[model samples]
Target: MIKLPFTLPSRPPVTRIRKCDAAQLRAPAGPRTQPMRGFEDHFVDIVDYIVRITDEIWMERAVGRIYDTYDASCTIYSSYGVVRSVEEVIAGTITTLNAFPDGEIHHLNVAWSGDEDEGFYTSHLGHSRSTHVGRSSLGPGTGRRSSIRFAADCVSRDNRIHTEWLIRDNGAQVRQLGFDLHEVARRAAEADTLEHFIVSPETRLEGQTPRKLLDLPTDTLDGWARHMFHNIWNLKRFDWLARYYCAAATVHAGGGRVAQGVRNIGALYLNIQAAMPDGVMRVEHVCHSEENDGVIVAVRWVYEGTTAPGGVLGECPAGKQVFMMGVSHMRFSGDRIVEEWMIFDELGVLVQGYRK
Candidate 1:
């Protein structure tokens, strides 16, 4: 049995399990009679607390209560690439509230898994201000707002929040606030192309199979595979470097189509080269299938680039470079690519570079 640094809260007693004849065994009614709460319950409570705080800017109160109940310090890691202690987190919240009194946060969903004292929770949240003008500290402007579908992975200790990794829908937020995402993305793509155009000596095109890619250290391979699509898609002009993935396939979802397989992989490279002249791609993470077969692979990646005039997608003018990231799941057949499912931060890319 695992022991917590603090005493576990006693839940209301549940109905006792009734033993019946082997032939009459049935599920029990009401809550289970187990005296101890499981990891699931702990996770539920933490999620409930997060939901509550989002609805009402209860950072100060919630942080104190969390510290008291869990007997641990609370830290908040933000997607804006900022980390703060409970006190700083509360302060930031207060500032936001003061600047936009009507600002509110809406929690959409939370997906989590882990043990009672240690686990991870990912939640989607949105922030909005109904009135932007004449708000103290907030400059006069249209009452504009943005939504962010963010995810946070947190670790808990002694029932209190510990470490957290926050991820934000950067592209989505920008687009929602009336940004010209397409132009920005095009520009960024072009800029990235100009910056990292040369094929490196380390670049291997022919023998780069999924298994070979996976041959790197697990962490390195994982990162590369995750972002393979974005890198290949954004930097397609370097298709010669991706000869191994030329025959990759693709799968589609969410009303969008993703090209996969080796041939599809080639198409991805071709498309990027055709669409954006100067673009760069980066792989953030790659999650692999558990099957020992070297055929299937999946990944997530990010892209940044600048646009040149006469872009394949449209009349992308020079000047602005855009940055975007996305996730993809791919499957391979034999040594060739087979299928893929893809999603990206389209809105974020548009808004950051083109928002008026």
Candidate 2:
């Protein structure tokens, strides 16, 4: 037994876990510092860590900070696959920054879990609202702006990050940048003709396992995560939105996709089911936090189903099977949940579907 020091709900089918203690739950919510060479005794506030990641590492072009904040062997997992080593992360980081040189990422909120002993993890959901003025990923810049949403979960150890899982709204970016997804899809295939982008076997093994499986919800986050996957979503009871979410809640489903309030979010669900009536969802991993009054949860999940007759967007249903990997970040306020940020590989969905 892990001895979490908290009592879990015993409800039949789905049990809700109770909070550990008022005092512990209210423990220091702010950042703390730890001694580390070359870091000048930097505070371990994971939020601060996140700030440096965006401001210093990405925007400021302080590539050396990556080495300072990330362990030499840090591994990053994304739709593209697994990336290991600080050098790889540095190269990829430069590539992304090159794509959106003027792009600045803003954080809506963060769900943090774990301690330095086991490694700290931050489930950060936010907006990368910026313009495409540089020549990179999307090819030449259209000088157009894009407000892409992203969800990144990272684990830090030895005063540095060692693992990460990042999901972004690429489809929204391509479209907002005034480019056709099909064109990008075609280019992606051509670029990968040599299987150069495939995930390495070792990297695959590293990514398949999660580092710190904790979130901000103390105990109940797990129950909500489990219920959403096993019941509400799988059963397609869109009405359950009200039961699980706040009346004025916001749903940030990435790719510039958003729905406000329970009713509107429920409508999006309807549209989703309309596209993939037989969609099946599976929860690959769920991490929750226990330190704050509210819970921040990050869930790694997969959706698989064939397109319905109407299909998604304007495509006709050819019974083409589509699969997508999504990372969802939810913040709970009181009984019902408040805001949720979600992102998946929209480009991957189109590629997989159109290729068939």
Candidate 3:
């Protein structure tokens, strides 16, 4: 049984994260945060850099800009697989653009940390809308329009992105394209061309030395995030949801599904937990930024376990170990979460669980 939503009155006020607005984010170039020494002159800040480059590459049809934005040996771990080198990145982008033709990604929010010297890391939340007008890995044109949400975490230094972790709601896209999820997976498995690489926490943070924090932050958002995953997700403590979330909290879950209340949020959460009942969630990275309504927190995580019977994937347990990489952005209203946006590639997971 679910309990009534409760609040913590003794929680301290939020003050660390600086408040930002869309206008300021899209405003003319000027330094607002850390110094961007090697970055382009037009980029005001890291957020602007992320937002503009994406728009230029996707919307403006300037594919060549990738050469300037990404390093020569940049690596990208995606819902598909690991992408190495700028050439592969360029080719993939061209293929996607060719397929969609009119596809465009709108940047929703960017939660980031670090400096230009140590490399700034950004968790970018985006919404993409497009029409399948040309051929793609999914097959020939279906002439269907689809909208999905995606999250990408990128590390940048000296004006070039070095590493990135990207995940998209491929399940939602497949459904929107009017294809059977299991059928798609089976076909992909038969093709046997998919890399099936899982982006684990260690791979996401490879070769990066940890920097000591000079002054610890007072905000407990990080602690709250850990408790949500460890206790609620791992320990199956549903009763504790009310303590960390608002009664009317809304969750924009994977596959383009939205839950209106805390109960529905639990239902969505239960679906993933049930899929990998024995899976352990490992939080890879966490960052928060002040926004209009409250503080927005970004979390990158991986869930590893064997597939079980009667999960959301609509397939019985096959004893296949699956690693699900996901990213979630939570909007906190003071101490309690008011809204959450989570993105994971369910279609890819289904493919991973298939054996034929």
Candidate 4:
């Protein structure tokens, strides 16, 4: 019998009694049998089973228990695709537990949808301790612990989980670990490569001159770059590339805006190129999202250059080669660029150059 956390509304109970011999009662099915439960009842049972598994048996423990019970590999998928597998999951969990033995696992909520064979489960793990702090400027602070908030779409067969698509709130977990997210995001954005960013095809001019932005082909890098700057960056020519921003395109540099524009971007790139003639800009990734008729492109970029002309940010002196990642979001119209948003690490770049 399954126990429920809450009581149901009262209903009249039938009081019936029948006399039978001890042997007959002990027999399998001499005369009568209880009605079998339906699939809905079984579905509820499965949900309860998972809840119990997560809370009572596996709470605060490593993945050993989960793996043993499910007999299946645990997998995690990011926004793009699979990031880790069950073995890695187990290793990471053990390592984490070793670092934070006093960690508490709190179940914030559980939600499920679809049938018993295919459903999604969303849960949150809170108050995880034992995070390590590194020597970076965005190191972890004291008294804070990380957490895992995740949603997993699962497929079950023969009363066991076969596969799962898990999406975790990594950003939140990182923040909980006491690392400076703004700094991390900035650095990540600056270090991104061409393969990590993307632009949508639905972006176009909202009003006049929509045709120009719409006609831009998606084939070449220059076309992409031009479309990206014109539509995405909304910054003034002289201001830091960290101002005039949007959430879609912004990176984490102390919380400011990075605008979109051609001249401004040209000046920024010129500054970088002049400082490091050997520097090469590579697109790491490009993701596209459609908004009505307009398209938004999210781009990840990496710049590799030597500080031969001295450090542009006062951190690295001349002749020092460095690599950095950054992210950008652009709105396009036809073939022309209209607006853009961007984010990256300004302080870290300067610090790196100076320290190097």
Worst 10 residues of 4 by lDDT: 11-20
Q: Which one is best on lDDT?
A: 3
Model 1 lDDT-worst window of ten: 193-202
Report the C-alpha lDDT of model 1 over 188-293, residue by residue, as the tens digit.
4444311121222123348664322323332243444433444345434344434334343454421123555545545554544443355556665333332222
Worst 10 residues of 3 by lDDT: 8-17
Clashing residue pairs in all predictions, respectively, total 52, 10, 0, 76
User: TM-score ranking from best to worst?
Assistant: 3, 2, 1, 4
lDDT of 4: 0.40
Residue 257 of model 4 has an lDDT of 30
Candidate 2: pairs in clash: 9-16, 33-43, 214-288, 215-288, 215-289, 216-289, 216-295, 217-295, 218-289, 218-290
**Stretches of model 4 off by over 4 angstroms after superposition:** 1-44, 56-62, 69-74, 79-81, 117-143, 146-153, 165-177, 182-356
lDDT tens digits, residues 1-356, model 2? 22331233331111111233323322333334432233324444555556545666755688888888888987887654567789988887788777777877565556555555666666776677777877765678788888888877787766577888777888788888888876776566556422113311112234455322234343464655766655555666676677668899998774567899888888766665566666767777666544334555678777677666453433533576665668887767766678777777667665554552
Those runs of model 1 whose alpha carbons end farther than 4 Å from true positions after fitting are: 1-46, 56-80, 121-141, 145-148, 170-356
TM-score for candidate 4, residues paired by index: 0.36
Q: What is the lDDT of candidate 2?
A: 0.63
TM-score of each: 0.43, 0.74, 0.85, 0.36
Model 1 — TM-score against the truth? 0.43
